[model samples]
Target: MDSNAMATDSTSGPTANETEQDGRVDEHNGPGKVVYEYEDPAYRVFVDTLNYLEPEEIEQVLAAYRFGEKAHQGQTRLSGEPYITHPLAVAGALAEWRMDAPAIIAALLHDVMEDTSVSKAEIAERFGKQVADLVDGLSKLDRIEFQSYQDAQAENFRKMLMAMATDLRIVLIKLADRRHNLQTMAPVRPDKRRRIAHETLEIYAPIATRLGLNNISRQLQDLSFKHIYPMRFRVLTRAVKAVRGNRRELLSKILDGIRSKLQESNIEAGVFGREKSLYSIYHKMVDKHLSFSQVLDIYGFRVIVRDVPTCYLALGALHSRYKPVPGKFKDYIAIPKANGYQSLHTTLIGPYGTPIEIQIRTQSMHHLAEEGIASHWLYKDSEESGADLQVKTHKWLQSLLELQGASGDSSEFLEHVKVDLFPDEVYVFTPKGKILALPRGATVIDFAYAVHTDIGHRCVAARIDHELIPLSAELNNGNQVEIITAPHANPNPAWLNYVKTSRARSKIRQFLKAIQQDSSSALGENMLNQELQALGVVPSEIPAAVWERVIRDSGKKSRREILTDIGLGRSLAAVFARRLVANDEVPQNEVSESKPLVIRGTEGMAVQLAPCCQPIPGDPIVGLLRNGQGLRIHTHACQATRKSRTTEPQNWINVEWEPDPDQCFDVRIRVTAKKVRGLLGRVATGISQAGANIEHVNMDGKKPGLFIDLHFLVQVSGRPHLAALMRSLRRIPDVVRIVREQE
Candidate 1:
């Protein structure tokens, strides 16, 4: 019988003594009493998978199935099958992994709460709390209104992850649910099918891989591939089958060789021929730009051994028989994958110079690789075999909580989760010899964040293999990294361009947002106070009622929000100040102009020196109140703002530089120098001698015949320092002309 078909077609009726019964009758049913006589074909087919469970446990699962069947009596799927069949199939899938009774029960009723009138309390009363919670976690947040489909999807994902964090079985059941959906997605519309396929291929497949459910992950990918690109999938499937047929003799020979070698070494193992999934084949072909022939590792062998030590012994035997390909061997047994998958992988040159891939691992490791967290019944507290796998899975789940807390919204949280799901890990080391596995292309900042969020926040530079490297440097396998942090150092916004890990990106964003809010609030308060003082009013003397009236009229939640809005330039500070004093019965004089705000270059996100002019201290400047973006400062003669100043006069605010600024400001300078050897070096040396650092250099080579125009973005303290640097550059004989550049 087809495994997926839930005995939907009736057969001969049950007979006396059960000799020729259509379905297997439970021996547990008392004499003259039949709890379930296979009347429900779905239940009959599903019962066959419960052989591993005790009689009472199977009865409980059957009970849940009956409840779901009754609840979904009138409902049918897109496939036109009774809705109960769907849950039964999901439960059967989980049962293949030997999941506990509660998980199976949850699977059997995963959709009741969402599609029917059954409540969580009712399910809890019927089955139990654990099963009810799993079903709830697997349910979608459809009833809760959201602005868009993306919002609803992100919220549902977030909710599911939170539930998974508490009990990992939720993810297992959810994966099974998704798997069954993909299998029966033909009846779904084409547009919806494509969307679901894309989502499954992008998200659920990677998630399954992360959990080390290699078998299920492959199935999900292949099913998604079939729906998303039916033509490619069909073409690829035919091609792979044809190739397999042509190489059947070669495959048998390789399998025989592996078996003989393992037996000769007395390594007692099971060697099986493995074929790459169609989706994997297509992925490899597209990713590597390879043709069918170029994908040499499409056919491989998996050697399952009795224990860890024998795995290596069998690998040696296989290598002794065939010439091992150079640099094609990996010892995952020593340092397992982040998902706790352990295998010794090697490639050998088979007959006719074709490459043969071989993976040798213990039977236990193989089981874990196939079933992932579901391989061991986590409900049982004392499963020592899966202890390491549980720990790794737990750590990943815990990070979801952290990401959820740090994220500003559901969509942002979903993006972070996606970033973490596709981890092609590269293992590195800490200074103290502790091994850390990070996603491929992860940088030093990612490492610091992986170590701890606080470390990532304060990280400045790193020493990789005892040599100082930039924090954005990509770490490699086996590199020992030591983070160099400073108490005063802050996360640079530019780090977002290179940090690969989600934790680092989220933490950096979180920190920058916090500092921005603080700075904007302070700036808003200062601006308001200055404006009030110009009107001869003291800010402190404003009564509570007056402040409340202004806040209410502004449509803001509290005083701090108003201040933040004002500081962010979303609201004019003068308008709010006038409103605050409007209700106050204070003696007021003609409102004189407010004193100019000082530009100290230390206001963090609240004050952004416009890149167009790159204003330095001592340069006359004006602040443009950009809505929601805080004050953008520009030099008085900046060409970029010249049109804006006249067109939007309300946005321009009076601003002046402080007498002494604590930080350097970037200024651009254009230098026309003779195109001669070492001319650029001499100019750089002159600028360095003048106490300025060149942040960037750009050469305008459009019409250069003998002279080259070099634009240098240099950091200087103030105008005097910039002038001195220009003077030093002018002393160079090759320098034709030098001018401070501005838009």
Candidate 2:
């Protein structure tokens, strides 16, 4: 802590109203001097911290101090102090949290590697791997370039998450670093301060809360609020101050009464008052649309005890002393927060009808609350039970690793990280009592997905505590969710709309894309086979291996790939299919004129159907296999098919869907719809009248409140002719833009 941080405020110190001007002299050219100074006298409190650490630790500390001082020798901070002061302040904050020797040492040297010629290996050798690793894990994301502030902000947030997942302490140091920076943010440019403070409020504070660093979280939230929304923060701050003034005497009486009651009960506890951060109060006002005074429980107290049992005793005593706010009590000791914080919380009407919140925890838990995971290292000796949360916390870290496998691309990996790294969680339970923590707003499907990939793939239904709930039902704290799965079940695309967990969302998307690819590939292969038959090329002659090689050379893999290509019109399936089959003695005959055919088949075959020609069951159909897509079935009379026969005739195929298609195929329909009320309903009614199902409907906005162009992707059996369907659609009143799917 530099043994000088805990300085007291003095009249000799620069007043808050005074400003420090920038000193940009060429200090590096000569002996660099302390470019600026600080007035945060609170740092002086850490002189005692030096007592517990050994002399070797002191060496590391001094080395970092000197190294950072020289590296930033010419640098003046936003507050116009020597840049070393910031690092000193950050180190002091970490010391106050009672972090161990290495963490404190790391804090001292945190920015040295980022801003100076000092090498990472140098820090590693001087300070040990632990401290160096922590420093290395800390981000230099700020020093990178981005297209826009938003882009930079997003990337930085992601980098921060990755860094934290790698080592939780980096973020701890970062929070400390951020707190000190924010404390002196006033000297930063107005815009820069706003951005920094807004980010701190939105993300860092929330992270601290999750970690149970209550004091630090409160300070961060308050500071960020002041900068992000000055008016609101000021208004709430003043209002809270007024309320505190009015309740001071009452709260005093209440605390005394409670203390006396506890003493009478022979229970000794440390009780401290807590005031809600201005940002929290303001957020409640804005989010719930409540007036400033409506935010109750803004004033609270914490009761720290010596043992777990004592915490409960304190809670009972608190309840006995005050009328506890109904439904406001929570026993986190049984169901700890995702970040491993455990406590007993109760809101009560304290003396004089003032609503107050009281939190009760053991001394160990209190340390955890104030110091977070870092306390694991700081006071681990005091917690003799072993690190209970190490495995669970590591599991959380492992799940974050699952995000690392989400995509190979850096940007995409970063995107998925954002989704998986949300610090806030809604802890729920499995039917058999296993706890699962998911992000807030996660649904039953997400819960199902979280249980297992197979469960997600086969999820058919869900029951919350033996009662059926919508798959989209949002699970709450402590919900017991049991997923129901069946072999044939698959995730519906609709799940995408409600799934909150990134894992679930990503899996669903991956599965759907795979399905689309397979379907398109199937259509492509079918067309290719038909084209091969037309060319008198036998499928039996060409070995699948040879065909694989040819397709691979073409940069397409698998029969599915070839089919998908044909369907998409990127490549003719007939050309490739015939080229493969004709590898033997088989010879292709000249092309024969034929109309397109629309065929119903029990098999998956669709006689080289061209979506452009929309060959009907009765039409003379010819197939064109796209590059590696679906087989495009085209009518004999189709202009595109005829053009292919001359320009790319190998695409022509003699093919057919089986005698009866078990399912309807997708067909495009464009309808000019009236803008009047119920017009869309009428259109839907018409499609039903023709015994067709509208699989997809997209409607454009109306221009003059009179009409709209509606595109419907319909599924229909071979029972309807294309010409007849078009005629029926055209006959409908108010139908002007009706067209078959076309170029």
Candidate 3:
């Protein structure tokens, strides 16, 4: 049966063996004796979870469960079990993590909106708005049809994350939901299992890690690995078990040694050994190109102390006893990660010359390390600690919202978030000594955006450690960076090449999009004006009703939009003008005596001269009207223009340079000169004297000391100015020949 149909059926009534009582199932014998079954695993787990909550909180959770149970009454899972069991399992996982009553309750009702007829408003009235919002966030929109399964998944993830940003509890509930789903995916189809498992691995697991829920993240990874690569998982699991059996004595010795040393040092601590997860072990093997036997350090130790000071004492004692592996120690306690994980990590040469990793942290730190943002609830009663964590998480969420605002589409937003999910990071400092952690390989542009959007948009250069550096310079740990900004400066498209942060990329893309639209709008206006002139009618003389009709007919919003479409090459200005004048709304008057379209190099991005022939003033030029790209002016002699003229003569329009154009255009010239030390210098000096700037110089020395080919990219006002420069260069004694390079 279809899952949705099963879910709908489940909401009808209780099963044959059960009777409804106060929205719950009560077992009844033939003689009217009522029996409540407490032996079920789901019931037992829920009861166990209640032990961690207060009496009132427990009642609230139970109330939500009863409501959810009634809503999902007749629903059966793919495993043929009652559908309510799924939410109970999710709540059980969250309860295991000691989440607050609201979180647990939300988990129980997370699927109500998706599977049942319950509305968010109803849930809110029964529970609070917070719980309803969390449920709604976890619920999927079944009505929207996406282009592909991948698109649907990406969009769903995007929605979940946006909701998560508002209240982190949504993601906590989502992770719990995913964990339970993966745990019970045995009966699912292979293809479905693989797709869900891959998603769990790629999206959910990384988010769990980023949020610092290590236990959930690790479990998700192993479960995903099992489904995505079952053979490898089985092989690695067996290998780990065999190794554990062989190294039992060695692990015992190492644990005993650490415990003994901590006792001797008068440091009170709890020491235990833990084998790495199968997926992690496999990851290490693949990442390091090692065989199963070669992947050591699979077993690690965790030393939990009473407080921060004692954590250091315990670490020192352990290191003094074991041979420390050089460069394998990290003081995360000194510089906590963005997720607020604080621990000291060290690797040591243990018994049998094997390597073992160790983690040291206080009891509270250990809790935080395991739970991450969820620890906020663990210390919710403490205003200082919980509020600080909440604030940090909220700040990160706010940044995500900013990215969402800047992103052009859902896919782009998801792509940016994926880039932000990378765990590796480098901590850099500002000029004020404030440290800002960024992803590894993040450049100065990413740093600037991390500071502020305006600063990033205006940034032109940077100084790392008091040394001026390029904006693309990769930042390093502890380097103090100072961004140099100009008020009028804007983001360059080239900045996208090296920016590592999503925020930087999004902001740059947004700026470029805005600029493109503005330029296209302006170009569209010009093109339409030229078309109107060609039609022997003035724009002002065209009836407003005709423009309105054209706008309506073209499905554009307004005159400006139509023009922008024309400018962007989405539509032709001539066609639009023909539509406007179809009924002879404006009478023709001797071709309107229109002046030639003027060319000024200062058109910025709105008008571009084709690079093929590099048309300058005094060069015979024609404008090619392109869709979405405005007008592209080309010289008559350009081969590209000649080819396009034959095929698309209608796109061509008359264009001429403005008298005495003020801006310079680039032109290339080739010179063959005697290969000598002063030959290039003399040619450059001659060009400079003729009032032209050499933008580039390419020299070929295949026949050294005999003859050399020189290619110069020089800026000139017009063909006359270029000819003057070429004549000046030709007079040089080392010059054998000089000629303008043609397309």
Candidate 4:
């Protein structure tokens, strides 16, 4: 039997209406009532914590305990104890937080459906649908087939998150279940222990912290650290023990000094000392690359006050007594964290010049800080605080729903959720004075997405603090951002390189995928028509039956599908044309060829210029049908295409640029100039004056002389425009030679 629920050996007298059987109390039943006198000590402990609930609710909880106790009768844990102890302990942990009846009931029966003959329908029939739903959500989906362990985990997490979107309490129960399992994992094998510990550290601990359950989060972290790094944990434990003994006197002196200062200021507060958790210390050491001995500020003090205003007074009193470390003070009370955490944090030089961290907050704030969402029932005064945290959590969960809607698969959803788990945040503002909190290193595009999805999709540029900035600019703590949007603007593929938030990335990808499909369909139609025209055939002239036959023969659903395949180079346009025209009796080569396909500069992603050769509009170009990459245009003289042209002649298509393309194309040029102070400035000015824009510039200093080669990637309208810019640059005094680079 588990130690928590072992048979009692006490020598106390029995009470009335209670009888002991095999050192356990017999079940007592009455009219519309359920009771037990001296059941398993663990169940007694769990029941004692439920005094805060109504009498009827408490009876319902006891009924659940009875049901679970019977359901897990034959099951045994790795320790050879009855499995009921595990659920009992999990429920007891939640009861300590004063969770409501349904939560407690769900915690007791969370694993029954997964491990026993119990079903969700039975649970619902016994309890209410709400309780059954909570239990079902807590159960893992391992029974369903998956390709791999990772896929199963991701799908399970995705299912839980969807459940959490409906009710936040599901995760709470699940976290508690995980907590007890980790506590009793000693009997498990070493590899399994490490795997469970790693998952807890990576996913559960961060989640607990994100939900503002600081106390539970710390315990989970420490437990996971102890399992994952046993040797390191022992070393750190010994080190902390030694340090604690040595710092005893210093800690007392600091506490006395803070108490005296607060007393002198007439600030009524409770000041207490706190030690950093082992996991926190270990992470700090690893993150800052600091030795264990060099890690100071390991001990801290917290001042709990009556209200928010008194928190500031307590902070002032402490600062007046000790010199505060510069740039180490943060006032989260004014602007709470995204998790609804609020406290005044400061680091002060202690009696012996050792830094000591301090946090000052109201009593309610302290309660919410430790209990987080559980504070909704843990304390009566924390209702408002719990509601605030709930709002933030609800918003986060809603974003998960949006991510699920936009994500392609479970693994991708998991990737996006992991990206969002970090709590480090930067608070930025909009032009209208509304505040938005985003993850640290978030860019302007993330801010726009946080504002609204439509704004993000249409945003072209942004002005940070009244200065025009690119969409990729990293936002700071108090940046005032004003997004510039245009109706014609759309998300660029390059934005994916710098977008920090998953929402922005997902939205951009979704929009790009849609537009890419449309562009591909149009391009495919054009290519197919061009091929058909060469056979003296028009697509519109084809009968409905013929079109259906072609689509079905190509194993496509519709005409658009076939066209898109052709446009994406997945199917050769010539093959599709030949198939479409197979029924016709036209002789090959009997009809004169039609005009070559025209290349429009506004084809979006359907037409891509070959970057190796940098072919401009005026250059003679041919289309290379790259598999899954649409048309790749290259100059006929390009060296990269020479081998492909000979080996893969069927993939090549004749294409010509429009007479007057509206967009400029990028081309590379080399400028050999005598090294001088003003050489670059003069060349840049000449290029700008000649109506060309330099997109990139590089200098080669390999030559051991006063001359250097400057490589410029400039955008121009055509060959004539590039020549004009070259002539202008040639007039510079330090310019020795200029030649366009083509390869």
Candidate 5:
């Protein structure tokens, strides 16, 4: 049995909670005193909240709490409370939200294994599988590691996001856990408090908002705000008090008027005046660098209704009573935020010209907005109901799990997640009248992709509200979108430079890279084919049965798969092809007589033509290896002698060109015009006429066109043969600058 529930025995090894509470008794006895209690305040509260649960659930939770209590016997928290008190408190918080049996039970055990000797299997065997999974989620990553202490914090944030993506409740439980710790944070060393506070402000608060837990979000924000900016938090708190002091009666009047208006309109609503949390106010002041007096919209009203339509009616009524601030209105009802919050938000100037923000939503939306992800658990009516809510929230929560699947690293996942978790949203409509929720500043491309990956990849154009626009055009709220897609269209590399969501970026990069690797493999295979054919074995002679046997021998996936592997330089194509070709079952003499293609340059050196000779494929060449990379092939007469070769002689190697190299090579040739008009075009024509593809040409006028070096990468034969080709260009009278890089 767990010790948190009613239990008798107190003797145990040292535990934080039980030990701290028994400190006084320990002083009388000695260190390591076994201190047991009748029942902790946290568990008492937890047991009290179990009235809504079935008798079985009550027993289950009670047993787990007691077991946890026993496991934590003699343990004390940093706050000197029984260590069981923390888990009990976490359970109490979840119970207050009216969570189901599993969650409540999980809360009771969340800290057991994380801070104690209890293992996940122990919890599973004692409680159940559901409870254990929840507990496991609340546990930190197996370990935290970093390149440096500074990076450890970043990794913590990284890990937290990764965990939250799978089970949002894990984060909620953590938040509740932190809230309790923060409440008792004074007992913790001061040095750690500020860092925790800053982390809370930056990560937890935003997540709370994303979860639609406004109440918790506000508290976490305020606590973090005070710690991160103590002076500012104090000043803002005082300023808010002063502002409310003068406007207390006016605020009452406004609240009363709103209440009265709703009543008169026959709309049931819960209306209340809300001053922004001190932390939020502090952040606003510091972040915007504004004075206390300048932050006029410090207080607002929240009007929660019973149904979705009532939310809009309430909004209309409020807008009529107060002059709305133009362009400040947002209708989240039609397009809920990424966090599943739905409402109508509008800012208005009251009779005193004070800007007041009003949020109108159904009671359910209000629940979600305030509780965020936890609202599902709190609002669940039964154990089965709680499971269903988990299913529902899981749909959203689980995406965090998949978001990281395609990401190259945790940081990539974090980037996409941060964007998706942004609190604000814009509602755009499809031409068919369906509303799609997109982040603010989302473009048509984002919308197209958000619909479906296939649609996104094939999207060529978009028509927004009957106007054709660029794919990257930012979509405005309420614009009707029509996507133009083509079956043949593929994702472009350019899309990667601007895509916002992690999904879109990952998918695009995956596709483009796959294509590139495919092409590379094809090129490598073709080169290997020519090499093999020279070995006198007909590739076709390799029967399918024999090819399969060879592939099995090589331990490769398949021929195409293997070819792609070789193209990416992952495998040696020459070696693999020889193996496959030798098993062809072809004629013996035919195989023996085939000649091997000679490749120039020593292995793993930089391949560059000797600029002095400008050697081509048909030219005799040698290989000279450079360090780190394979041998480089250069023409014999290339003027560029290696500086690294002489100094780093160990890096040098031999080189030679393939007798029949199959690929085109770029070589630069200079040409001088007779200063004739259109001479550049004619020179280009002459180069094109020489059976060589001109890669690039430069005809600059530094010496007033007296001479010009038009660098043209042209195809040619050996050094002597390329010399003859340049001699052919010299006959054109426009060839004033005739130098074949024989430097």
Candidate 6:
């Protein structure tokens, strides 16, 4: 007999009104209405679940239950029932799914630490450290204040996931807890109900699906849909009922035909019709833009046999009897899904051209499809299969750890996890014939990371089916991919635009951050050295003690960090140099004079020449020290600079052009020419002869046989080159006028 059936509550210690007999609890007639009587049904369900556990394990579960019952003795749920009933319901669900004894105990005590005064240490002392730790992982940090409700929720979720990474049981218990909560949310306020339901749909449902718990995922989705859109749920529910009535005869005929054919082939199988979940039908309607009648697969069938070989045989038998739909067959048993889902799915053309979807699987596979990772505990004696499942689950959780390390914050980590949750996978192969499954839109970079982190970091090119392709190429199913890596190659920021997987995005972001830090440090050092030279002090000659003092004063770690800040425009080098040299000790002549700002087109990212006026060599340019942005050179005639001159005069600095500019710049020009066949040709020829390349051209083609306004974006060395080009264009026969365009 299970000890849970005999255990008494520790606090109340078996009240006189309560009686325990024959492994059952009964309440006698009393002055007050008995809450225990109301809870007897749930207690019986819990007692029935103990048959799956060993005699020794049953004692441990009873201890946990007694402790939880005492901890939550006076507490009541939102439904005005004893709080013990909630935990009991969650434990019952886990038991029905055949979860391990430890998991069941953890589910019973999941809320103890958060709601009661009980400590993890006490639970650890009473029930072992494993149960205590699981309860701790499920408990949220409710007392801490957060910036917002969303922030608190995100942090709580992050903590839960981190704990889940350590032990997969934490998440399983959490799913059970959430399932029970979602099932009993009718008494909640409307706004709160919608919030909780939406979160379940978005976060928990996807997690359940990813963990291969399809039954729980589907139930969560349907429950959440009912709360989120009650009207749509009702309308769809009625419509499905109507459809079921209309299709009863057709579904019965299909089932009978499949059963008769299998029997004739001496195959014993169970054939049954499966209706699509309401949430699934609603999702299909919204995503595929289909009406209620357009969904043909609403009524499908599942065929379960004894073993894997029989599963294939059933598929063959079904295909022979009915015409199979082309390109609608998938053999998941040969290659199980990432979530360990295996089945043979095929669609057939039924009578009157109706499409009937069918799923064939073995008995064990069917169990796994419903319970997912939890199915391992159903047969606890089979340790080998349990270990195999653990290995696969560990690999997926390890990837989550990688994502967390690469992500910037908790919110970003959550977003990346969301991206990985719903996987419409496309399987591809490597050069060695090893297969990898990725999301449908996954690219070559995603494949490289799926192979290894080093390969992803150094991925420079790829070969799809032995043909060279760009990195942004989307991978197709069954394609052979070969990634080409170079030692010096690095991730490009542009790759983030197309890379689909969270792993690739996270890794690329990490690489970009490291590169930016290195570049900023180098630039900051250069700026500080230049400033020190102006102060008559060599940077290398500075004493270590003085440098340490400066670092301490600036609240920075080292000279490199300070310099990096300077280079990144986060700090001013001149201000720091003045402090380092002591303003009074510096020469007055050097302190009073301003340094001349130099402009070269090759300064790269540190100096940007504004595109508004397109400042180039020989143009009057002014440098503006925009906050956190190193020198921005703008033309004198530019309206943006003119506006800034009034609002922020101190930010403006004088800048001059280099003597011999090597880089070309774009300048726009307008040419008013007569409408003629050869006019455009002559203008283009003149500009070409002047050694200016036309980057782009726009003509006023709205009116015919009139003066045409031709705008050309031409490449030139400086203002002199542009002037010469304009002069040359004016010399054309049909050219009436020509001038440089400015903004």
Comparison by TM-score, 3 against 4, better one: 3
- Model 3, range 1-743, lDDT digits (tens) per residue? 12212453635222223333332222332222223344576675566556666655765676687777888887888788888888888888788768888888889888878877778888887789888888888887676998987778777888989999877888988888888888888888888889888888888898888877888899999999998998998888888889999999999999999999999999888999998999989888889999988988889999998877887888888889989999898888888888777899999988878898999987777777777777766654333444555676787788789888998778898899888887499999988888898999999999999999899999999999999999999988789999999999999989999999998999999988888778878777877788788778777888888888878888889987887788777887779878877866776666765566776855756688888888888888888877656678888888877778999987777778888988889988999988778788888899999999999998886755688899999999898998898888878888999978868
How does each model score on TM-score?
0.90, 0.71, 0.89, 0.86, 0.70, 0.83
Give candidate 5 misplaced runs (Cα > 4 Å): 1-39, 143-169, 189-191, 260-268, 286-289, 305-313, 380-393, 516-743
Alpha carbon lDDT of each predicted model: 0.83, 0.69, 0.81, 0.85, 0.66, 0.80
lDDT value, residue 701 of candidate 2: 78
Off by over 4 Å in 3: 1-39, 51-60, 100-102, 125-128, 351-353, 379-386, 535-559, 578-596, 641-644, 648-652, 703-705
Candidate 4 Cα deviation (angstroms), residue 384:
1.3
Assess candidate 4 and give its lDDT.
0.85
In angstroms, the error of model 3 at 128 is 4.8
Minimal lDDT window, size 10, model 2: 1-10
lDDT of 5: 0.66
Q: Rank candidates by lDDT, best first.
A: 4, 1, 3, 6, 2, 5
TM-score, cand. 6 vs. native: 0.83
Candidate 5 lDDT for residue 388 = 40
List the pairs of residues colliding in candidate 6. Answer: none
Least accurate 10 contiguous residues by lDDT in model 3: 23-32
**In model 5, what is the error at residue 256, expressed in angstroms?**
3.6
Candidate 2 lDDT tens digits, 1-743 = 11112222211212223233322112454332223232345333443355455544544454555555555666666445666787877888777666777788778777766666566777776667888888777646656788876776666666666767777777788889888877877766678778788777667777777665667888998888788778877777678889999878877887788788889889988778888777777777788998876787777888888888888888888788889889888888888877678899888887667787888988888777776666666686436422655555566666656665654444555555456546367888887889887888899988988899889989888888789887889988878899888998877889988988778877887776666666555555555555665565545655767777777778865666666666556776556865575454444456544323333532233223456755545555666644534355666677755556888765454665556556666678788867777778777877877777788898887456777988888777653554556666766787776776654
- Colliding residue pairs in candidate 4: none
Better of 4 and 6 by TM-score: 4
Per lDDT, the best of the predicted structures is 4
Query: Poorest 10 consecutive residues of model 4 by lDDT?
Result: 8-17
Q: Can you tell me which runs of candidate 4 are displaced by over 4 Å? A: 1-34, 37-39, 66-74, 116-118, 468-470, 531-537, 541-566, 570-596, 642-654, 672-691, 705-708, 720-738
The local lDDT score (0 to 100) that residue 308 gets in candidate 2 is 87
